[model samples]
Target chain A: MPIHDVNVMILDNDGVLRREGKQLPGVVELYAQLEKRGISNVLLSNNSRVTSDGLVRQMKQFGVKDFCKDQAMTSAEAAASWIRHNPSADRLEDMRVFAVGEEGVFRSLQELGIALANDQWDGQQWSGLPTDVVVGFNTKMDYATTMAPAWNAIHRGSRWIHTNGDVSYRNAAGAMLPANGAQLAYLSTTGKEPAAVVGKPNREMAESALRRMNVTQDQARIAVVGDNLTEDMGLADNLRSAGWNAEGWMVLTGVTTAEDCDDPSVDRVFQDIRQITRALLSR
Target chain B: MPIHDVNVMILDNDGVLRREGKQLPGVVELYAQLEKRGISNVLLSNNSRVTSDGLVRQMKQFGVKDFCKDQAMTSAEAAASWIRHNPSADRLEDMRVFAVGEEGVFRSLQELGIALANDQWDGQQWSGLPTDVVVGFNTKMDYATTMAPAWNAIHRGSRWIHTNGDVSYRNAAGAMLPANGAQLAYLSTTGKEPAAVVGKPNREMAESALRRMNVTQDQARIAVVGDNLTEDMGLADNLRSAGWNAEGWMVLTGVTTAEDCDDPSVDRVFQDIRQITRALLSR
Candidate 1:
């Protein structure tokens, strides 16, 4: 199905709206098209380095003045939200999380009033066992200092939760920098995957975005628009599997190219987000 | 087939001869039996934390008066030796090694006259690209401070070498501590195995020890004694594959129990090193 009939839009950041700090051509027009068509839009990013509010500020700088903080959902925020609504929410104050990431992860958890486990060692072991180990994208993490404590904590029975599973990200110079999943791979070598992943391809993030749009899965047609097939297209497939009428729109702007969209998950291919936006608004 | 006719003994340190800073029962007698029988012996340890000289001092403190540094081999020394004998040895003077390890690794490379690569980042990248990245046992390494440089260097085409592949090691309290291989697993997430591993199960270390014993593989009936099947028994199997008449003697004093010696690679099972030594000299 074409995205022209969809009333709700789920968009990926980084590659779709912008590439390496500069807004991609037609981003401003894409938002205008969404508004004119009365289609609710949510910006979803697997990047947990920046908070949703920070992303909104970034979007405003990129000339998307209509995008508000409420319209953005980060994996970090989704993870904290998941924890807050889970069965453990009854004793949220008592739950201790050992977090491994930068600003987005720390700030999101802090805002939710979740207690962070002490990382300092008391000569023998960690100060205390954590209730959960949350990992995000951390560029300054040290293996012996940061990872060792987390590894030992998990071995001692802490639940492992990861914000996203992006193996690599494209830097400004187009170099592939190791991402959150690469570090998670180090932790997973101890023989277990993370207990929960709240980013793209996971229904939790899509559901969180859909809830923000105030649209039920059965009430509207949804289209996920982005560049990478594994993340954006995978999310569309996951939502469709969960009974949502979702379609994937692949754009050739960052990381992926035209030849890479030969997958059944991708329902349409565009030169950029501008072309997709025009197609979605044409009907 | 029995060790009674074997003239060369390859022994694992730690578990067989000693346990937790103290010599195991009959360790001194076991060494005396080898000396009296005029059999050549080499103490091999996958531990890259201590140098061979340091191991000699440790053995001397445990009552092995005749033990010399030349009779000991650590993965650290073996790695350095491997670097010296390979085709890369021709440019030893021009080669710079980026070492991610402790005193044993640093000291061994320094003693071998190999220039150490500068790990200090000059804001953009490493001061200079390393010719080889040697990873050993390092407990104090952090991901950002230590591993980032190693990861970046490897991505830039530096040869990756590892001292050993032991995933976990038993600490003094018998608790398992993540070893060098565990850290290496983090670096390996970038999709490449190490170019060389100089420890157990690799024929290079065994060849280095055989060179020290002044014996050719065909000239001696060799018996490897250890409690771990993966390292010691695997080393015996490796040597046999390389045309040596090597036998594995599984001792029940350390990591492996008697019931675990059902593998065909384990030619004989002894209660301890003392019992194995007696069997080797019975003849």
Candidate 2:
């Protein structure tokens, strides 16, 4: 229940560690304290556009040079891991995916030996039929070429899976931009909910992260610290409801403001990752 | 309320007159009977892609050689008409619109002496900031280039308007394709409803059609005949609710079936336009 008692910490990327392309204060120290306490941590991010490798590089830029790919889990990676574990076909290699995302999504699926349908986004081109229509955060997806085909495929009975549920993401200028949830809403006009939304607040991504960390949800003392209440704190709430010893730690470093910290989802609140590091170091 | 007493008829294009690009039986004879009786008819279509010119051409193809531009009203035309009457600024020319649609939408807006913002759909190219963001049926809309910018504009204080609410449209192959409603849903993740949906079963298009036909809603004996329940019969319901002498006439030629005609929205049911023609002639 205390900061030191937390055996594993699941930290959000955009707000808790780095923000606006810069490493936030105290993330390096928080990592160091977790290492000193012999506590495991997963840099869990709902950003489906980045791979574990991309996350590790970001961690290195944040002064955590020791952060490895094993310590990082992106929604894209979680999607691949989830798909690999829950195979739609008899064989893993036989599974065809029509993925709408960047390199992270493509790489993760490829690592699991999943064949991608219509990989290229070049003008009105298509490959084999997709068994699964996987939607991630596609910043450059076109409706006629990419989405219409995906919609058609889904209508024709392909299983739909979204990477996350965040409809809008804040840009550097503090402007809201369309995210995967918005993309999901476009397809949701079909009146079918996705088979899986493998991201934050969902059990799939957390389960995958816990498995990767060699920790069981029911036994491990987990703490999910995030700036977004619905995603980060909500993830903690989900874990607790699932019978895990998890707490949702809110940080006022991103979207969540001081006024929003009083929510039931927030078990604990910190000004930023620096305050969290101070709390951990003091204990 | 008798069939012979109907002075003006509002017919849906897709289901009532034709289906999948071919003319349905009884439409020609029905037009003949209506012309002989001096009863006015307006071809009301929720499809924003086609202009009045296109509808006239389609009518000619359907063997109704006398059908003119004045007898047709598309959602695109309705949108322009709605905007012209309800201008965002003091003058219509001063109000800029970022329209997401085909040539029909462009032509309609242009004809109303309204300025268009970002007319071209070329990649990442933008002309100007929009005061109004109008969404119509665009089969070729892209996310990064078109929708994202529109989403950004809406968030930054732009009035949003959708031409129609039908999410999907049946293609020539009988497969449902993404329509403007799907595009509207995509933008709806902003948590804001459109300022106006200038299509049926909304009152804007129907009212515009009434004006075009020189018939006031309160006095004119109106019959709305279409195959779909929600858009067609629903228009009649809306009209009647607004104190109009309007009857919903259901046709069995389109999306609606024989069993669906039992709903409260249906005032009368016929096999097709031919059956309606027979009833009219007999009367």
Which candidate ranks first by DockQ, i.e. highest?
2
Which candidate comes out best when scored by TM-score? 2
TM-score of chain A of each: 0.95, 0.95
What C-alpha lDDT do the candidate models reach, one value each?
A: 0.82, 0.85
lDDT of 1 at A180: 80
**What are the clashing pairs of model 2?**
none
lDDT of 1 by residue, B1-283 (tens): 6556788889998778877667888878888988888888899999998899998898888798989988899999899988877635467797888898889999999998988885444433676678888899788776545666777777778888899988766556443456787767777866767889999988789889898889986688998888888899999999999999899988888889878889998998888877875675675
lDDT of 2 by residue, A1-283 (tens): 7777889888899988877767888878888988998888888899988899998888888788899988988888888888888888898778888888888899999998888877532333334557788888887788766788788778767888888999888776555778888888889888878889989989778877788788985669988989998888889988888899999998888988999888888889898988887888783
| Location of the lowest summed lDDT over 10 successive residues in candidate 2 chain B | B119-128
TM agreement with the true structure for every prediction:
0.90, 0.94
Question: In model 1, where do residues sit more than 4 Å from their true spots?
Answer: A86-94, A119-123, A126-128, A172-175, A280-283, B20-23, B88-90, B119-123, B126-128, B172-175, B277-283
The CAPRI classification for model 1 reads as acceptable
Give the alpha carbon lDDT tens digit for every residue of B1-283 in model 2: 8888999999998988889888888778989999999999899999999999999999888888899999999999999988988889887768989888888899999998888777532333334558898888887787766788788778767898899998777777566677888888889888888999989999889887787777975669999989889899999999888989999999898988998888999999988888888898893
